[model samples]
Target: MAERRMMLRDPGLQPERTRLAWSRTAFSLTLFGLLCFRGWCRDGNLFYGVSALISGVALTAMLAGWHQRHGKQFLSLSLWSVGALLLLNSLRQVLA
Candidate 1:
């Protein structure tokens, strides 16, 4: 008798694509945070400064845990947070 390796038949490419999305989301959030930080450092108040800092931290944590989460929840949360950051960043600019 010979031992054989077992693998999922499809091993679908969806996982890879989903991971890429997470990576992209993380990158976008981090980039936004850095840009906002720089911008706010000049005329930005404490509110913006703290918000930007927190966003950066969140982005880092998201990237570090990206591969350590379940598919549905991970994707949903990452995307929602990304959208939130974008909204907040834009709102800061508009209100200023």
Candidate 2:
């Protein structure tokens, strides 16, 4: 009888890459939120304030799920929330 050998699959650095990507997204959201807050403070506009609040909430959600092994759902929802807020804000600006 002949012996059969099995090969193992390597995951490589995909996990690390994913973590780094998330970190970059978090950093971008933080910067955007800060800018929105600054705009609100300077112009006293409700839209800017609301946008800032949404960004903060999204960022918080991202951070809350950062250490979890299965946090993709949380991150996805947060990103979608931010996208929706941005779209609404853009439409408001265009209409006004």
Candidate 3:
């Protein structure tokens, strides 16, 4: 009898690339939210500050989900929430 080692095959690189893309998107969104926060602090507009804060939190959750290879539902929900918050932020500006 001979001892043998079993190795798992590589699943290719596409998943890694997708994960990286998601991380980059989250990073960019976080930066944009920070800019909004700074503007809100300067001008005293609660809308910008609130929206940015919510978006930042959602983006952080999304990043965590992606990093952990969590279910798509969590990531999707966070992504959509971020988009909605950003939309509200823009509409508030236009309406003002």
Q: Write the per-residue lDDT of candidate 1 for residues 41-80, one digit (tens) a residue.
A: 8865555566576666667667677446543465556546
| Highest lDDT against the true fold, candidate | 2
Ranking by TM-score: 2, 3, 1
Looking at model 3, which ten-residue stretch has the lowest summed lDDT?
Answer: 1-10
Task: List, in order, the clash count of every candidate structure.
Answer: 0, 0, 0
Any idea what lDDT model 1 has?
A: 0.66
Off by over 4 Å in 1: 1-10, 70-96
lDDT of 3 by residue, 1-96 (tens): 133334544678879988788778777878878887897899887766776777677677775675466635665665576667668877987999
**lDDT, candidate 3, at 81:** 69
Query: Which regions of candidate 2 deviate over 4 angstroms?
Result: 1-9, 66-74
lDDT of each: 0.66, 0.78, 0.71
Give a tens-digit lDDT track for model 2, residues 1-96: 133334543578878887898899889989988998998999887767877887787788778875366556766776677668678888988999
TM agreement with the true structure for every prediction: 0.57, 0.67, 0.60
Q: Considering every candidate listed, which one attains the maximal TM-score?
A: 2
